[model samples]
Target chain A: MTRWGMVIDLGRCIGCQACTVACKVENQSPVDAWYAPVVEYEVGRYPDAQMAYLPMLCNHCTDAPCIKACPSGALHRRDDGIVIADEEICIGARACMTACPYGALHLHEGRSGELLGDGTRNTPSILERYAHERHIEGTVSKCTYCAHRIDFGTEHGLTPGIDPEATPACVVTCPTECRVFGDLDDPDSPVSRYVVEHGPTGVLRPDARTGATTAYVGLP
Target chain B: MSAPVSALPQNVFMDRWALEPKTQRVWGVNHAGWFTLMGIGGGVFLLGRIFDITLEAGRVLGLPIVDVVSFVTIAIGGLILIADLGRPLQAWRAFRNVRVSIISWGAWADLVFLTFGGLLMLPDLTFGDSTPFSGLGWDSHATSGIGRVMLVLASIAAVVVMVYAGAVLARPRSIPYWHSVAIPIQFLASSLAMAMATLMLIVVLDGGDVTRSELLATAGLTAVLLVTIVVHLSTRTTAPGKKESIERLTRGSLRGTFLYAAVGAGTVLPIVLGLLALGFDGGAREVLAVLTLPLLVVGGFLLRLDTLRAGIYPPVVSLLEAAQR
Candidate 1:
């Protein structure tokens, strides 16, 4: 009955990349791995130059192509509408990487375990100790919408979108409060209300027919 | 009072209209190469088996070259596929999910094809006879019947293995170039063309006469390959991203590979050489056949590589541009 989604208000986003840093810290991802990245591009010519930023992450589509493409069934969708990849079962065929039009999925090449030229390692000891769920070598990884935080918050009688503790790190860290996360199916939810108020929100590659859950307002 | 400068609307719109660069493909030349070999090998064995059954051909000379090529290439392809995996050890899990995954079906099909193809070739290797159980003094008729059954099963599996390679790539809705219905059909036609070319080469080398039927088959398959390429290129895509991908193949960065290697050398050159071989005689014909075969084979591989390379992800900015349009 629950379909989790995100609404990004491009008009309000300053594109400081605070959310990107917060996501990396919260997830303890590898130096090369980015769970959320802000894609910045120059819009105009010299006299009228402008920069536009688009934050990219997994859309977690209702009809996920990655789930169908995974030969090992390592990628699956939960009942709550979150799509996840099981690292243990992943054979690293990179099928899902090709299947995703958004370019959200990434392969973790185990660079985190590599020794540096001076015999020092790049991955922090704290990350090694606490980020056990971080992707291992030869496995595919992607954003999970911070399901762990949501589940934990729900168990503790807190609402995910309303409570900072229950929300995704990127959503919580956004300075402009541009990111909205809530159940799309619930008419009363903030995400659904935002969509209704804004009148029109665009999903990436709607032509892909993947039924992307993430929507954006004022994308241009 | 001084005022802050801001970006113009036209500049913002232009930025939103710009197409993003192509994403890095996970399936690259290695995957393309192995899949092509597998399709060619499986197709040759299946067609050769069918020919032997219908034409009453016997095991001539010593080696069953067609069977050997079939089993070897498929085996090697299967190995390469496993090695290409990030976690090669977990490849066995491919069989766990067959309902939705073309890759899972491909793995199972490869297994069946190899097993049955190997079984069909057993009597030839062991007893030097066309019939299984002949060394044991069993009824030759019964052994032949069993061989036919095995050949039929192997051929079915071989066809599936060949098509499944294309199916796996085609099923991804993301890449418009590979998502077309023509892709699998094109792959199947190219596989058969490669198989026929290989067969022609082997026959010519072995001093066996290149039969007219085989030449016709090769020509027909080459024609199919050409038509499919045209269809694949001409087909209109609904999305701007897909249209951009098509442009990349027809006129953009991938044009050299698509036009020169895949279309020119692979399809057109082979067809010309095949036709010229039919016109020539003696050593001249053999030379033409030999030259023609490798071109077709290489072309097949290049076609796959071009398709893989041309797979452009849907542009993120296209969503914004669509509203303006």
Candidate 2:
């Protein structure tokens, strides 16, 4: 059982929003919607202050708070520790968002179709931008770790599926090679080795027992 | 206002109409007045507690004035809700399904928050010679336990409170606005905002106020407002009905509620006040803090009230109009 995790090196990060754009395109998220967001914090005062960007998405904790908070089991943490949302079953409660300390989850509007006055011939607009694909509202969304791509790591079994293409879009597109994604369980994995070489700070809510898989290392 | 003691006509339809509706018959006092008083009292108690927690961190032994007041306010609010109920004992019946009922969770959360408050006060009452607790008499262990329990229960109650508020307005099908994932976020955000506002109002009315907490209150209010805005903005792609409701909130007659209350007062005002206070002399900061407190509270109240009033109750509104036609 491979547990997936990502190591973000704040030292190498340049505060560019490439990861944000990459995650959006890879996930086909709405133009205005955010799956991976880069939040910039200005530290120190005036001239001494430098911008520190934290690119965030679902940490996919082993014991996810979002999953526990959802009254409707719309959010599920997969066996691989990738938290996924089932849009159809979601009641749009948004308890998950409140529970998420990182503020990674976003509530996407669910649309079945527009009901005409006569209640027929529904007009669809989700495809208006995407050209054919339709995404609904009333559903919460977050980074899914691109499970489909990771699942088919190879077209015909190339290199044991080890971090080859298993890295998330955000991880792959990081300009300064700040983000690292691989199986946390594999000691030789880049993410695992990075964590071992330089101890990283895991996400901690006030409760501090959520057990976040994603770690932020060498935050400047 | 008192109802006129007019005699009912003997005709069945006329007599039925003549009898005053249960809602309209004055309970000897004004309904709006009672609601206002209740709101004010509860608001004050809530604010006091928040100030105590934010400023002092609740580190010292014994109950803070805010904690005692908050517990009392909660109990009073619970009683009001029960009084409004048709079958008050059925309140217990609500607990039968804690899994599904937000109301049930709210009741339990209230119980937990209050119980913790009371238990903390117990050691003080035992006549221990501790400084803060010496007034009453709680032991150090008892105080710690009480604090820990209160902290956990308060966090849980916070969510339960929002859930109960949102559940009242939520309908998955119709009024698209209420159907969005932002329902709980809005409710939770508004509750915290109101809680902060209520605290500020009480501080304004009371003497010997702690000014340092004004900063913390502003910070808390600002954080919730930012989150609320994020949630509200995310609803643009919601169902047409919901989108229309959001339009009403942002651009229509209901825009005042969103603009003045949620945005201007709740968000911008608090941030500006906090920042302004940082630059001012003590005297000016004190005055500005006093001024901004009410604005924040009013903002919170207007936010909740507007959201409640503007909520589309769906087929009820349409069906009633159709029936009249």
Candidate 3:
């Protein structure tokens, strides 16, 4: 009964984009397909203006619209409440893209955008950096909550949020540790504790009622 | 909160952020193209059942002329859908989630419409008047009981194809403008009007007699379509006020396309022309049908394209809302 969830303390995020770099390195997403990126906006105007960073990713909702809107049955939520796409059979109709209120879904462009003819060169070039990406081309991609690390850690008797090995690449790489990932079902989990202490709201577009598992501690 | 006309609306704090509304790039002109083709094809096919206009028309390559047009148009639309897909080879997998997904439902409907509709026309192409059905005292394949059953099935499928295009857009709750029940009704009205107008033009150009009944139906449908568009545009302005989808369509960059082409040329122009034609008889009506019909078809396409292009995902952060906060 593990409902995996995340809580982001918006105040703690410094807009450094370490999570973006870590996600790219870990997931090897194509140039256009940013799995996790910090979106910043202005709070005030002119003389009183201030930049506000909001780390955005897949909320991994309880009643996920992307899963329901997927015409190819490519998107599915696991028993643990982690919504992952089966890229093997994705037809890439992009119905899920329109359905997601948060704009979480992204199409994985096949090309890695390396320098042309870099693959033919012998020296350490951009080709070496993107030669072995595991992502399937022309499939819809999103933040998977680092299911790979979580699965391995759980099997090895390690707690996800507490252990760096089990944690998501973005969560672990975060300099301020603003993002917290844990099982929502566990009453003693960090996410649940944060929910109790700060009462992080479910999602930005609450009217849609996606039942988003991810919550924000201080939504601007 | 007025709609920001420019792509970038002076977000000084962050260079790249969702400050103003953003148009959804996923389903744009490509989707509009496919939907328009399929919807018109289905609408024309369905309209033939209501009136004997298509049945009275001569055959092309041993198949009813309407059937040939419907089949080819739908097939071309199918090609467009495949072309839009990222993985075109695996397009068959689109039917894997028909239960929950409206897009899947549309795909299934398209299949049924093609299969049953194609089968209904097969005998005419194969054996003509002296086929197996002719031996059973039926002059044509369309005169048989099974043929009538197939027609019923195909018509149902065609109706679904016409409606499901709008339903697919409306299913995405993310886009506030599209998230409405009126969209499907408006689409049905618009498609039917365009379909009827196209049929009349074809009949007129081919030196066939123009009927008043056909003209009236087209006019009625066009009027309904106009009402739906007006009502839909005004009512859908509730989400986040100025930077909403409706605002983008009505007052933003898409204003010319929506107000002029879709509303003026597509709906109002046709209705006015239809009235002028209906007032007179003989050659004048035929000429008006010729003039108005093309406008309806092109306007229909523009209407769909503008509406689709106007789908603005509500601004992530509004300066006005932030100021109020």
For all predictions, the C-alpha RMSD in Å is 6.8, 20.5, 4.7
lDDT of 3 at A161: 85
Whichever of 1 and 2 has more DockQ, that candidate is: 1
lDDT of 2 by residue, B178-253 (tens): 4455665555554554555445444544544436655666666567666766676565544433455566677877
- Candidate numbers, best lDDT first, in rank order: 3, 1, 2
Instruction: Give candidate 3 regions above 4 Å deviation.
Output: A45-48, A114-133, A200-202, B1-15, B126-141, B205-207, B236-238, B241-243, B317-319
- Candidate 3 residues B1-325, lDDT tens each? 4323232211111225655566677776788888888888998788866777667776775677887788888888889999888899999999999878888888898999999888887766645454443233222246777778888888998998889889877876777888888788888898899888878876876678778888888889999999988888777366662236676677778888888888998899999988788887778989998887778878888888987787767754445766555
lDDT of 1 by residue, B1-325 (tens): 2212111111111122324745344677888888798889988886775555212333433337777777889999899999989899999999877989888888898998888777665544444445443363222122566666776778888999899988877887777777877888889999999988887777766667776677777878988989998987877765555677778877888888889888898999888877877887778877877787888888899898887777766676664453343
Better of 1 and 2 by TM-score: 1
The parts of candidate 1 lying over 4 Å away from their true place are A44-49, A113-133, B1-19, B53-63, B127-149, B237-239, B242-247, B250-253, B319-325
TM-score of chain B of each: 0.84, 0.64, 0.88
What does candidate 1's lDDT look like per residue over A24-50, in tens digits?
888776544677787776665676767
Worst 10 residues of 1 chain A by lDDT: A111-120
lDDT of 3 by residue, A131-182 (tens): 3366666788888999999999999999998899999999999999889889
> Per DockQ, what order, best first?
3, 1, 2
Q: What is the C-alpha local distance difference test score of candidate 1?
A: 0.77
Could you tell me every candidate's TM-score relative to the true structure? 0.87, 0.43, 0.91
lDDT of each: 0.77, 0.54, 0.78
For model 2, the TM-score of its B chain against the native B chain is 0.64
User: Which residue pairs come into collision in candidate 3?
Assistant: B1-B242
Chain A only: list TM-scores of all candidates.
Answer: 0.90, 0.83, 0.89
Choose the strongest candidate by lDDT.
Answer: 3
